[model samples]
Target: MNRFRFRIRFEDRVGMVRDVAEVVSGHGANILSLEVKPGEMHIQVDQVSPTVLENMLKRVQTIANVLEVTPVEWLPHELAQQRLRAILDTVEEGILVVDARGTVSLCNRKAAEILGLGHSLIGNSLKHLGFPREILTSLGVGRLSQQEILLSTPYGRLRCLVKSQPLVDEEGKPAGAMITFEKMSQVRRLVQSLTQPVMITFEEIIYASQKMAEVVALAKTVAKSDSTILIRGESGTGKELFARAIHMASPRRDNPFVVVNCAAIPDTLLESELFGYANGTFTGALKGGRQGLFEFAHQGTIFLDEIAEIPPYVQAKLLRVLQEGCVRRLGEMLENKVDVRVIAATNRNLEEMVAEGSFREDLFYRLNVIPLYLPPLRERKEDIPALAWHFIQKFNQRLGKNVRSLSEAALRRLYDYDWPGNVRELENVIERAMNLAQGERIEPENIILPEKNLASKSPSGLKRAMEEIERQAVIEALNQGGSVRKAAKILGVSHTTIINKMRRYRISGKTSGQWK
Candidate 1:
């Protein structure tokens, strides 16, 4: 028996669909399904010979006002399943389909690998396969959403981020369930690839200031050692850049150089991010667990940015790893020895934190083995012109403008400001001016400086004032455009830049113009 589906288009008239159905049935073909719409009818038939099908097609064409008739490649159900399989196969995540009784119906290759099911998975019961009872119960109740599952398979213990939803029948009754599995390690790798791309070297640290040059020279010297190095500086003083330069000059430069911002990740997640969990350590943990940034940076360097923001608990664990040269995954008894070089950078004063008992003194001493201080942009004013030109050339290529140089007046304005954000601020300012510059030379007006009164009010520190000004600018731009992309265009920056700034300032579309 052969199955076929076809679309027949005809003039709008009563009983035209009935006539097609009659023709199909008269040709000894069984009509499986028929859908009638304005001027068209889609029909699926089973148990039809090729000769009889051709005769039926000719008979249908003889009907009055019949415009076209074409056979489809697959039956409706077959086409839907084929499309679904194709989509599932293309995704990196694993996919599983189970019947209403919790028996596995289908599993994709990724699912098989992640679950250690080998090549055979179908017809197996979730409970018999060593799946958690909670998952089986959730599937029975049709309440399975996204949850982490730990599976003990022939291959090994696997941790998987699992999401399940019931498949509904025509009457909206649950017929089965479909679950997706994503390995946490794969997710971590993807995120790392997208966010951290270290390409900077020691030569890329453009500076004419003696203070910066001395700092770079010291950093180069220390790069030869595997000791823990702590870098101290004001925010935006190119701390991470210096860390990257150190990594590039080190003997382990060929390996991965992983950077983690302690302040960026929440306290609860930071521990797992640094020292990955073992299989079944927590709900929603990836199958077979994951390798944390420390493991990923094995035999290389792990730059802990904003090290002072690390919670006390994680600080203790980190100190242990530094002293013992090994890390134990959460919930695992065995410790894995790692040969990683640690480079920690923080804008905050660690000594003060240690005195206040906020930062562990032992960890502080451990990280500060060879402390490197990066002077603020205000203290290194001589580097302004060189850095400005460096950015001009950079933005010239990025923004596609031939900006030659900053005018003398523009240079004076840049030198006057106390660059509270340090090199990062200067880079942003120069990029902004390059985008707004009408001619080859950037003018003084193009260099947007903080208000004199606002800067004076924050004499103890200009960081807060500068942040407020930036927040206001982002809010105003967002208000004018009502979208991040449009606001980025109005502000003469990339869409991602605006987004990151919005996140930094905690600005949202709904909360525009309101400062916290």
Candidate 2:
């Protein structure tokens, strides 16, 4: 089709456009587009021969108030479209704009690449891409929505967040829809940084015992929720680790994971730290009043470790945050809302503190919503062998040593000792052993425990105590019976059960009175 663009400089008058339109119509050509300015007008028309275009331009020049007419190849709208296409291609996300009839009028390079389509996406119906016709119609007519949905394309199935905006005329009528496609994977990676996360999951807790297994299962179950969680354990039981693991497993994992050690901060600054102070509230405050940990944890989890150590005044403020879903600055009276999930942990007895009137009763109840307990290391000796090897491998890389594993006697020493400091103490002991070991494996002589932690009593807990008793009983019976069968008779169980128990406890001997 022959299309012509003309730039006509005309006087600023009302009837100038009507005269030009009548002249263009007189030449049997259709006016494709028209743009008018203060002293200039740009118009494009199609289906005009070169001779006819020359005649039409001469007639338009003779019209009143039409000063100069110049024929051009590109109109202002065409130039604008080229710039818009370039800008849309520069965007990282895919951009696709459809007209009111649901036909794709504009699709950037990224959009075609993501959809595994050729460069030609225009004139294609969005309904052909498997989008529901009714939904596309609604979006085409300006009923916009933002949703994360699964879409199948020529490349593969994609999980994307689709956002739409209505293209409207000057009178607010729908002209088309401008839709954007953002791959959810990129968004997740952006939200949840690969290297910066705490990187704790339930699998990393390193426990093989049934008690710890049950605890891990419960933790994983509760990780799906947004409720407040209170992790109860003694010092070094990995309370903070559990808190981080829970946060990583939660739906809010993509957002922030703010951690505050209540015991580490002084009581005087606790309130200001948990709830930020207003500007100039104190002598050395931030210039524009920094946000508190709660606000910083918006849309994510805030781990308040050593929760029992927070002062009574801070407890009341924290209670306000939990109960009201909001926090007030230290000096500011306005309550700022936050969509944060709280996971508090403590190594101390909160009930005892409440009874002593050192902690708030209301705050205690609020924090105790979902209580998860982590057993002390001494109580779960079955995990010792695994935990020892885990740390052995860890410190091997850090200390640049090649320690293989702990010796049988070294493991027995660890299994027998009472661990007051729990898993943290075990890690320290293994590190020491890793440094002192001369051979491939850590031996009894290389493993050292704090003299105070090593007691004549065996590892605590009914489970381990019973296991120790059964282990000794098996050794004694083996010494007296001199055979598995006779030992089974002595223990009042089947020989299969005896063998299994002995194997489980790592007990074995060939000669009588020489059981190890």
Candidate 3:
């Protein structure tokens, strides 16, 4: 059978495409594919001779509103495939495709060069090609996504990031899979260039309190070592800042310092994000897989913030990476060695979690190799003035404000209140004051504190009292400011937070008088 492609230009009226298809079918030609655009139809057909094709075009031209019909060298599908092949070949990354039965179907030149395979890899069974059985099993399972796997090829032990997706048939059944590959060395260079090093140094950690000073001193001391450091503190205690400072002080300061918030990423994706995945491991995964946070931080540091929030299943994998200095992507069994210093921070009490069996004791020990506890803002009250001035200076530069200093009354108000939100809260309060303050110095009125009456009444729990106070403050701010943005500015919070609080408190604009 011969193949032919036709480009038919016609009026973009309804049924115009159908008429073109009918003409091809009338000539005893089977339609391979059809693509319709604004005023043109691209059709591919099989079992048609040049004379038959010309006759078919003449018949198509006779249709009303049809302008022209021309034969092209390549069919639409063939041209698309050629373009795709050209694109894949041009890229430095390697591409591989496999059938559902684990046979190699297609591979680009880059793949052959990277894996040291022959030019023709089609129809070869992956198992027969000496691929690791575990990797083959993972491909068979078809659930892996963005995994990293080591391939022992003729080129040597290649640590490649592999990402795989299943090609489904019309019935939605698995037909085959396509994967892309990238060498770890290449990935490392890319990651290193993209990832900025930790700029916060030990000198940047401003503290006047002895407790904070001691913590900084310990962090500086431990920064010189390769031990895993666990930063324990309450939320908003600047644990990540300390972690960044430690990374800056380390010998691997020049390398990538990657940070991953365990609580920010969903549990389903956290593993693959940290360990990466092999190509063709799962459906809809990125081509060539991706380098996980651990892999990206190889030869440097990875700071896992909110470490206690990591799910139990991922905890075991993390423990392995910590102990073995290597990580295996979600599906592949081969481990890629990494040289990374881990710094995990958590506001939750891991010891209590271990006692309750919610957190692994072994993992805790591995993470808590050198424990550094940061004092909360209230505990380090003496540092409040300095931190406040520092934030004032920062905001002065950031917001283009020239507020000179904080009033004694404002300082006293800050000192009097127990900062449940820690240093982060203080920074926010200063920023808000800087934005709202009309005078050169921040006054007590400029400081947006929680409702003292609500706080005085609710002596039962600090957290509950703080919430009540915040809710009341949001209500009052909305009433006074008359707009969400204005209220958010007055309350030192985001407009989204103000809107959320209004919803949570069941307060409406009508009740607050008016909303702009």
Report clash pairs, candidate 2.
Answer: none
RMSD of each: 15.8, 20.5, 17.7
Distance from true location, Cα of 339 in model 3, Å: 1.3
Tens digits of per-residue lDDT for model 2, 1-516? 577898999888989999999999999889999999899999999898889888999999999988899988889888999999899999988888888877898899988887777667778888876555445867645555555544678766554667788788788778888888777555544554644555688888898899999999999999999999999998899998898899889998878787888877866787888887775798898654656777667788889998877755788889989998988887776677777899999877878767656678999899999999999887899999889889988998899999887788998999988888899989998998888999899999988876752442456587688988888888889888878888889889987677557645656453234643
Instruction: For residues 399-451, write the lDDT of model 1, one tens digit per residue.
Output: 99998878899999998888878889899899889878999999999998778
Error of 1 at 132 (Å): 18
Off by over 4 Å in 1: 1-196, 456-516
Rank all candidate structures by their TM-score, best first, as comma-separated numbers. 2, 3, 1
**Judged by lDDT against the true structure, how good is candidate 3?**
0.82
Full candidate order by lDDT, most accurate first = 3, 1, 2
Report the error of model 2 at residue 281, Å.
Answer: 2.6
lDDT of 3 by residue, 473-506 (tens): 8888987888888999998988767765764555
On the 0 to 100 scale, the lDDT of residue 168 in model 2 is 85
User: How much does candidate 3 score in TM-score?
Assistant: 0.57
Candidate 3 off by > 4 Å: 1-156, 160-183, 195-198, 453-516
